[model samples]
Target: MTPDTLNFIIIDDSKLDCFIADKIIRNTGKAGDIKSFTNAATALEHIKETPPPADAKTTVLLDIQMPVMNGFEFIEAFEQLPAEIVGGYNVYMLSSSINENDLNRVKNYHSIKQFLNKPLTSSALAAILEEQAQ
Candidate 1:
């Protein structure tokens, strides 16, 4: 499915980042329902509470740097969820830092689709959505 019909969740500590990402996702006209959470912990909790359906097309853009739970920590927790609960969603780690360690760490997780640099762009989102369609 295209991004226009995909649900998007923006989990970032920065309010501005969330706002910008939200706008970018909206501009795609393929986004179904967009949700944002400044707190990673809250976002994780919400994920636990509301798992996507097996056929649901959803994507989560999670920030790697946060106060309590970073993206890695969130993934660690998210991994504990049932396959049916987390399997249907694509999770992308979003970060401004280009640290090699962070990039390598993402390789360890099968759930993470890819690492996206800060300031989500329409073209990037479009490409990701197209890839998912394949």
Candidate 2:
């Protein structure tokens, strides 16, 4: 999808990683707006309050590991959201984790489109867009 047509949300506990990922995403020149959150709870609240419209293009890049509420916990909460809001989102797990168990566990979330290794790369981003386009 074109950057101007998509909203990107990056949730990671590390400030530096969030910054770097934001930069990479901006470099693609396809992101309409990018929002970053260091905590999952706050992000979850925003999502709950302003759930994307059903026809809007939105993608969330979430880190698997975070203090308090991890990505899985966020997913659990997200799964309970109204279908109208949830239908507009494409959730991807973006993490530095290489654990087989962690990777295997993501399959439980039907909402997650894919589990991506970070830091996010241009090629990987392109692949995501391309795949989604198809």
Candidate 3:
């Protein structure tokens, strides 16, 4: 697979955080497209309206807390998405809070491949590459 051809979505209430993650992804020269949304509803709607192509290999870096729908709510809404796209991608949670309860709640989601702390680092990016390699 061409890793650079994959798309990514950042769902976070903080635009600054989104910008940082976007920059990191771009710096790595991976991912074909990157989209950011401040709210879960709009992001979910976009996913429902124009789903990514199966060949796109998309990943989402989602935040667990937001004004509208939280990450868990987003996941629940997204889980209802058509199975084709559901089966074709991954969602990784990104958060600054290290609350065990929150982490536990999110773990219930099978689609969530991993959790990432804020300020996406080079090592974290490399780890993703390693996971992809594995």
Which candidate leads the pack in TM-score? 1
**Model 2: residues >4 Å from true position, as ranges?**
1-4
> Would you list the C-alpha lDDT of every candidate in the order shown?
0.88, 0.86, 0.83
Residue lDDT tens for model 3, 88-118: 6679998987899988987798888998888
Please count the clashing residue pairs in each candidate, in the order shown. 4, 2, 0
Clash pairs (backbone) in predicted model 1: 3-30, 4-30, 4-31, 5-30
TM-score for each predicted model, relative to the true structure: 0.94, 0.92, 0.91
Which regions of candidate 1 fall more than 4 Å away from where they truly are?
1-4
Q: Write the per-residue lDDT of candidate 1 for residues 18-97, one digit (tens) a residue.
A: 99999998898788889999999999888889867555657999999899889999999999998887886799999998
The TM-score measured for candidate 3 stands at: 0.91
Better of 1 and 3 by lDDT: 1
Pull out the clashing pairs in model 3.
none
Give the candidate number with the greatest lDDT. 1
Query: Which model, 1 or 3, shows the larger TM-score?
Result: 1
lDDT of 2 at 42: 95
What is the overall TM-score of model 2 with all chains considered together? 0.92
Model 2, 1-134: lDDT tens per residue?
33345678899999998998788878877777789999999998988888675455588999999999999999999999998777778999999999999999999999999999988888888887776655
Say what the RMSD of model 2 is.
Answer: 1.7
Give the C-alpha miss distance for residue 66 in model 3, angstroms: 0.5
